[model samples]
Target: MKLRSLFAVAALALLVQVSMVAAAPVVRENGAFSCTFYNDGETESWTGTPGNVDWSDAQIASVMRAMDTIAGLFSNEASRKVNVSFVYVNQTIGTAASAVPLMSTESSPPYAPKTKTVWTADDLGGRGVASGSAASVNNLEDVWKYGHYLPSDYADVVVTISSALHLNNSLYYGASASGIQGFQFDMETVILHEMAHPLGFYAPGRSDSKTALEVLTSVKSYAGSIDPKFFDGTTTVAYLQKHGMGILDYPYAAYETNDMASLGVEMSKDGSHISKWVGYKDILMGDMALSGVVRRNYSDLELAMFKDMGWSLANDPFVAVPEPSSVILSLFGLSGLLLRRRRTA
Candidate 1:
């Protein structure tokens, strides 16, 4: 009887150990960023009610792969902890997936340990906090000036994917980039694009590129919605070195228009994305997202943009393939520039 009882206890212990392993949450790391996840499948933040589905093992794995790709790309070690939560919602076709970076309830702590003057500007060009000490902007602007988020800030960039995306065959949730199907969107690529917004590629674009040029031509300065000096001096100088001093017709980066779309969606353009010129059609940060194209890596120009926004690269910029040649002519091209609008918050 004693021997039989011991066997039963040992079997129970094994079962518990397996359960713990199965229940472990997804966590991925890189230089300064560590992304953790919360699977809020049943509780809908919008409705205050429980949903029918929860995140499956496959879904969690898919999101984890996306984080791995992002973590590998950035090399900064400022120690920013990002919390990603998943929720399912009913969205429209071609709308695909949507994500928003929410500011944490916690107030941002002072910028310290390293003292670099951080510059800030207003929508109307009244640049404030010109340069005295390290401070926290308490907004996405902080991500632009500092390599990491403020110490007191909630260090999280939240994302919400459509339940239909994972449930139906709408997304290709495989690890291979070449495996994406013509009828499906690459889940990893989509998530990567969404993640870029919080990491710093976010600005409502200018009214139009034409308007941007007119302001530069007349005033000989950038008067777009975003400050012309948004990029740090290092990035701007490096861009000029690769391109040329005379090549700047408008702002170095393309601007998007804030417009209303068919789905009652608000389309925010510009500084948030690369220009949708001929060569940039498939660039990760371009305004349009095609169905089957896999834009997984950052282009050289996009890397410079990130560096200007204060993110340190984990590796050299544009170290991977599929990076396009410099967009000297494309930056100023005005024809056939019309592209599909995306809704970002």
Candidate 2:
């Protein structure tokens, strides 16, 4: 009887060990970038919930492909590496989703907790690191500006997507953005957008107080002219002056606020994103995305912004997306087809 009891206990221990191994989160690594997806059907402590929803097979496959594509975008390019942790949870986010750099430590005086900056002199190619440069002066303008790159050993950012997306079937999880349908949001596009934030396209507590009309008034100054000199770093003054909105010695008194309206630049209401200004809506970092639209390329302006933020581009980040006219025509065709189907039915 004693021997039989010992065998039963040993077998139970083996079963528990196997289960633990199976419940581990899935990790995907690409060069210096890596993403950890928590989709196993088990309770994750990070979520602060009992049991997390498991990502569907299709969802997992689609996101895995997106990770590969995003990895390629920064392949061998970042001056430093980053790791991100993604979790789907049943919780309230500021929006349907959010991305935040994981808190970290800095070796400076006071030794406050802060992430390292990604846009260091090495990545910016010494562009804005000089004295009196805009980039260096405002490096610590905001509370969150202490650093941008999350620690590489672990996830520097935690990207949280509401489980509501899963329940509502709101996202199109196809491998290609071109396959997006009229009623579905492109999954890859959303991922790319959120990824840009932690990759150094973020600042906290800033507000884009300008209305669309106010921003439009200054559009002609910088619409067609993009120069490297425009990125010296003070709000949009450096950008505007280079394109003729202001003179070389534009007065310093006008920069009292972070509003870029005077420079024809607009950001989201909360100042968390670049506004989808007319003729520049195709930028990947733009604030809004409509259903059936696939925004994959970073505009030249965006690349300059990243450069200002301190990252080295390994490959040319510019790629032409479908023209606005072409996109409108395709949407019209899709609408007509839907109308015909309704009539026939």
Candidate 3:
């Protein structure tokens, strides 16, 4: 009887252990953003939330840390919230990862005026529209003219990450401790890049033209000359002037000149990123992700671009006020502790 009881107890303990291991991972939240990871239910190699494919605890934590870092970059405005659902797709989805902006808002007329007047008659005590011009008295500037007021709302962006590509977590946990290794892609960097896309860093396309102007007018005319407000020459000039560069020369220096080419301020097809002009390498928006090690932080030029996009960095310590060394040291220590625990467990 004693032997039978001991056997039964051992069986129960084993069952409990298996149950604990099978439990789904919990959702993680930081600031105004909440992340829920899901798996496609087909991949045999990955692990995480049950019914969802596998993602190790460390990988999930690293994603959360990436979110924290991005959240720190923006100042709170109008209680806008963002919920990111990170779905692990089985196949490659265009450049390792992609983000779809679920919702976005254009600022009132002062920021995105519908027409430009070639000539105004102040002599007549009232402005007059040029001949054949569609100029109206209701002209409003782009959202940026409002001073750091971009789209702010709950669940503004939804991102999907590819499970097909092997991701490196070392850089996510502080690359110094993980040591440099070749070939593996940095997951955190990818997340940061994808996150920026939803924050108003996107190529203007027909979809925007359709939805933005549909309600206002039935006209479906395609206007290629009207540059994206964020990427226009006006904003670029301001950004260049901030760095003491000549505005006139920026078009040549900052834009690409070949077929399928565009502003060099945008992602470069070659390895050289926009930051190269400013003497930095591996900007977050660079077209290609190179093998071997890469830095986790955005370059000064990248941050300036965000500023030009109308995001206020007044609260971001990385912009002007340097983060205290002690905070960084503490974070490193915590990361090490978590890694050690993960290894031992």
Predicted candidate 3 versus true structure: per-residue lDDT over 206-239, tens digit per residue: 3222211111111111133222112223334444
Q: What lDDT is reached at residue 121 by model 3?
A: 35
TM-score of 3: 0.53
Residue-wise C-alpha lDDT for candidate 1, range 52-124, written one tens digit per residue: 3456667667777777777676554433554454555566665666655544223333321222244444210
Query: Best candidate, TM-score-wise?
Result: 2
Residue-by-residue lDDT tens digits, candidate 2, 1-345: 999999999999999999776467766676555567777454433333333666666776676666666566542334444566777877643255677654344432232334223334543433433222112111111112333433234445677777776567667888777787786667777777886765555543223222111111122233333211122333233444555553223323234343344444444544346653443445777666677887665655566555444444546443336889999999999999999999999
lDDT of each: 0.49, 0.52, 0.46
Looking at model 3, which ten-residue stretch has the lowest summed lDDT? 212-221
> Which candidate should be chosen as best, given lDDT against the real structure?
2
Whole-model alpha-carbon lDDT for candidate 3: 0.46
- Write down the RMSD of all candidates, one decimal each: 15.3, 15.8, 17.0
For residue 283, model 2's alpha carbon misses the true position, in angstroms, by 1.9
Clashing pairs in 1: 75-313, 75-314, 109-152, 205-256, 205-269, 255-270, 256-269, 256-270
